[model samples]
Target: MKKILLSFFLLTFFQNVVAQTNLYENPNFDELAKTHKIIAIVPFKTQVQLRPKQMKDMSAEQLNRVEKSEGESIQTAMYSWFLKRKKRGDLQNLEIQDPRTTTAMLKKQTIDYNNIMDFTPQELAKILEVDAVISGEFETNKPMSEGASVALGVLFGFFGSTNSATINMSVHNATDGILLWNYNKKVSGSIGSNTEDLINVLMRKSSRRLAYTKNSKDKD
Candidate 1:
C-alpha cells in the first residue's frame, strides 16, 4: 500500500512539472537589453474561466471587473517582485516603473483595461517613456486575489484542493518592438494561493534566464 501510494504521488508530481514548463529567450536578447535601463510592467491581460455554477450569480460586467482586478493584481505582484530583486542587488541596474505611474499614464492617454491590448508594446513603451515593456496574460478558473478553493483531482484530493493557472510573460524592446524573452507556464495552486505567491514562484523560475538579472549580464 505504501509503495502504491508513493508511486501515485510521484506520477502526479511529474505531470504537474511537465504541464508547467515553457521558456523562450531571443538570441539577441543581450544586445537588445544593453540599453534598457528602465522597463515598465503593464497590467497583465487576464481572463477568469468560471464553471456554470460559479458564474450563476455574476453578470458579464461583474466578470469583466473581476478580470480587470486580477490583471492589476498580477501587475502589482510583478512590480513587487522586481522591486524586491532590485533591493537585493539581484537586478542589473534595472529600474522598474511603478504600476501606479504606469496606470496613470495609460489613463491619461485614454487607455484602460478594455483597450490596452489595442496598442503595441513599442507604443506603450514610448508613452510610458521606458526602454522596454513587460506584459503578459493570465488565465485561471478562479480569482487569485481571493484565494478561492479549488480542486485538482484525486491526486490532489489526497492532500487538499488546488487551483490551476496559466501564465504568459514576455519582454519587448521599444526600439524595434522585438520580443526579448517569453515564458509560459501552467501552475497548480495549493490552497491559499494568491497573486504574490504565484508571482514569486513564476519569477523565481525565470529569474536565472531573465536578461536584466545581474548574473545573466555577468555571463557576457
Candidate 2:
C-alpha cells in the first residue's frame, strides 16, 4: 500500500511539473524593449476557480472583492520582481513605475481597476505617462492564501503546498498601443511558493527574451 501511494504521488507531482505550458512569446520584443524608459505593471484580470466548498460559503460580492485584491497583489509582485532584477543589474536602464503612483493616477481619473480591461492599452499608457505597459490576466485553479504563501516562502525555500496558476503577460507600446511582446505560461505552486517565487520563475524563463534584458547575458 505504501509503495502504491508513493508511486501515485510521484506521478501526480511529475505531471504537475510537466504540465506547465508556454503558449507564446513575441519575436519582436527586443526592438520594443530598447525604446522603453519606463513601464507600468497594471493590475491583472483575475479569474479564480473556486472549490465547491468555497462556492457554497462565499458570497458573490466577497468573491469579487477577493478577485480584485488578487489582481493588485499580482501587479505589486510583478513590479517588485522587476525592480529587484533591475537593481541587481539584470536589467539596464529599465524603470518599473511605482504601484502607488499608478493607483493614485488612475483614481484621480476615475478609473476603477475592475474596469481596466475596457480601456485601450494606448490610453492607459498615456494616462500613466509611461513608455510602455506590462499587463496580463491571472487564472488559478485553487484558493490561495496570499499571506500564508509569503510566510512559507520566507521560512522554507521549497517545501510548501502548491496550486496551479496561468498568466498571460504582454507589453504594449505607449506610442502605438500595439503589443510589442507577450508571454504566456502555466505554473504550479509548492508550499514555499509565494508571489515573488512565482514571478521570479516566470520572469527568469521569459526575461532573456524580453527586449529590456537582451543584454543581461553579456553583462557579466
Best by lDDT: 1
How much lDDT does candidate 2 score? Answer: 0.74
Range of the 10 consecutive residues with the lowest summed lDDT in candidate 1: 150-159
TM-scores of the models, in the order given: 0.82, 0.80
Whole-model Cα lDDT of every candidate shown, in order:
0.78, 0.74
Ten-residue segment with the worst summed lDDT in candidate 2? 148-157
Candidate of highest TM-score: 1
TM-score attained by model 1: 0.82
lDDT value for model 1: 0.78
For model 1, residues 4-118, the per-residue Cα lDDT tens digits are 9989875765455424669999998977777788999999999888777557866777778778888998998889888877886766677999999999999999998899999
Q: Which clashing pairs does model 2 show?
A: 160-190, 160-191, 160-192, 161-190, 161-191, 162-189
Residue pairs that clash (backbone atoms under 3 angstroms), model 1: none
Off by over 4 Å in 1: 1-19, 146-161, 214-220
- State the lDDT of candidate 2 residue by residue for 1-220, as single tens digits: 9999989975765555533556454566677677778999889888877667655776777677767777888898888877777888877887889999999988888887779998988999999999998899988754344753343334334433667788888888899888887778887745124566566656765777777775565321
